[model samples]
Target: MDFSEKPVLTGDRTVLRPFTAEDADTMWEIVNDPEVVRFTFEPSTELTLDGLRSWYGVRTADPDRLDLAVTDRATGELVGEVVLYEWDPAARGCTFRTLVGPRGRGRGLGSEATRLIVGHAFERVGLHRVQLEVYADNARARRVYEKAGFMVEGVRREAALRGGAWVDGVLMAVLDHEWEARARTDATQVTGEPRLYTP
Candidate 1:
């Protein structure tokens, strides 16, 4: 998980690349969306361009985190960002996070982008597993993770407090083997291709 090396991943509708200080304004706009930040622990606030730029500088310098900017290929519009955090070489695993703007929601961009990231992690980075914790209330996000082949491994009752009430947090994970099997199944459905990777 070398953060210094940026990987360019192109999906059907979007492209993911390393985030730069120049992208601060775009990132600010996306993260400031109340709906986008509702389920996450981070606070949503309006950031001055300078403040965002400074933050990006520090984040991009981190050596163990992979933070990518999601962009629409056709329009070259900055839509959102996805992050893989807590890279551990010994464990060969990481945690995932994502945020997509209002205009980018419901188009399946999040799911597609997630699939691409997971593929890159297991195939390119040689990670054994990728995991995420999402609020049980975020059904849409949970569905996206499930579609991408993550299984719910555990649940923490009343783990998050949102909207003045306790909410459950679901822990999900997909191993390298599980992802390979899923890719094989998808390839078979799309082109009658034989399985290439097995769990």
Candidate 2:
């Protein structure tokens, strides 16, 4: 969805909505977290509040991507974010990524948030495929993606460098029809946390 009309997606545990300037503070804390940095970005990456503010400030106005803040519905607090970017219009595909901070981990909020946004991507955004890459060592993140219906397609050997060691990046994707099939099954079964997260 575009900035002007982005939808607020709600699930049993989390809510996904367009990012706000106020979210930058929490996001800064989340992004700088040791676990977050190790898994999602490089340790050498430097971030600043002003830069975060400036970046998030304009996210809603951007026409090409969908970036949403993931919030815990119980406390109405910002937990993390989920994004769909690198869109290929002709292919009807896009890349997905998500991160959960220390405050929101271990409660299955990330999984629920992923299901919500990926659902919106296929049903509302008219995307045919949603894909992502996760480091093989990040089992928690990969489990969340798998529970949300993404299947591992292959691995990119030594796709990322972490702590001076190369890490494999696992590629995963879910197609529209696969999501629809999962939806039908989900409707028939009682849905709950597949397992506790250690995030």
Candidate 3:
């Protein structure tokens, strides 16, 4: 599985494309959203625009990880990001994570983005497994992951402290065979097939 070639994945509701320097401001706003920060990042963490610009500017140059911007298909607005990092070449697996800002919440954009990138990981990149850790209290995100074919494997007890309370981190993963089976089933059921890296 190679992360060197970042592709644009197209789904029904969203598009996943490699990040550019221009995306830094929008990403900063999304990451700073209270709801987004509460679930995905430390509440007290501070991020500067210059830092974000510098970071995003080189996303495509990083060969070890894939970081794609999640954009609304209809309006072409940046919503969030879907990332696959901490690559294990021998295991052919990586960690997945995503965050949607308020503008894209409750619209199934995040779910579609998740499916698109995960599909690319297994189908095009030849990855064996995709795993993620979701805070147990975030049932909504868990549901999204489940819908995308990730299954709960275990839990890290008290993995994070949020708002003065310890939150458990639920581990989830989807294997390549499992994803392929689900894709074949979806195709038989007439569900939308994911399209990636369209020319």
Candidate 4:
């Protein structure tokens, strides 16, 4: 659960890094965006500048969670955030989630950010499992999770109310072994490294 060291993760299309206090104004807009509100939180949720400032202001100090801003490398704007929280030390696991506003959507940035942090969880943090829940209707998110090797566990019926209707929540998880397999495949493909995966 050590969050004192925040690392900057980079991809061709996006960068996942810690936030600065000056990012509050932009992040406030992103966190309060209607799409972000509907998907990642209760629809009735709202935020104020000071509130968001305080929230982002303390991300670096939290001992039990990792919160990193998702920056679209193309535009150099902080489009959203990726988080790992609810630490279970006994199980060496955590829950994963993210937000990508209009600026970052439809470009595969979400999936890239997910892979970056989840890789960190396994390769750097020594986590055994990572899990997430997405509304059944969010096919995009489901696909993203799939690309990251997260297998759907089951359905949580009527798990949430969004847009005046109840939506099924799809529970998905990826164990360290699964991720290791994926990582090995990725490395083999990228660097033409010998694939003697014993995991």
Q: Pick the candidate with the highest lDDT.
A: 3
Clashes of each: 0, 0, 0, 0
* C-alpha positional error of residue 182 in candidate 2 after TM-score superposition, expressed in Å: 1.0
Which segments of candidate 2 are over 4 A away from where they belong? 1-4, 191-199
Q: In model 4, where do residues sit more than 4 Å from their true spots?
A: 195-199
TM-score of 4: 0.92
- Reference-based TM-score of each model: 0.91, 0.92, 0.93, 0.92
lDDT of 2 by residue, 1-199 (tens): 4324577998889988888888899999999888998898866678899999999988888667889999999999998999988988888899999999999999999999999889888887888999999999999999999999999999999987799899999999999999987777766554453432211
Tens digits of per-residue lDDT for model 4, 1-199? 5555788988878989897787899987777777777778876666789888888888888778999999988888888899999989899999999888888889989888999899888888899999999999988788999998999999999988888899999999999999988889887987698575321
lDDT of each: 0.83, 0.87, 0.90, 0.86
lDDT of 3 by residue, 110-181 (tens): 989999889888888889999999999998899999999999999999988899999999999999999988
User: What is the Cα-based lDDT of residue 163 in candidate 4?
Assistant: 81
Weakest 10 consecutive residues of candidate 3 by summed lDDT: 190-199
lDDT of 4 at 152: 96
For all predictions, the C-alpha RMSD in Å is: 2.5, 4.8, 2.9, 2.6
What range of 10 consecutive residues in model 1 has the weakest lDDT sum?
Answer: 39-48
Cα displacement (angstroms), candidate 1, residue 61, comes to 3.0
lDDT computed for candidate 3: 0.90
User: So what's the TM-score on candidate 2?
Assistant: 0.92
Q: How many pairs in model 3 have backbone atoms within 3 A of each other, for residues 3 or more apart or on separate chains, i.e. clashes?
A: 0
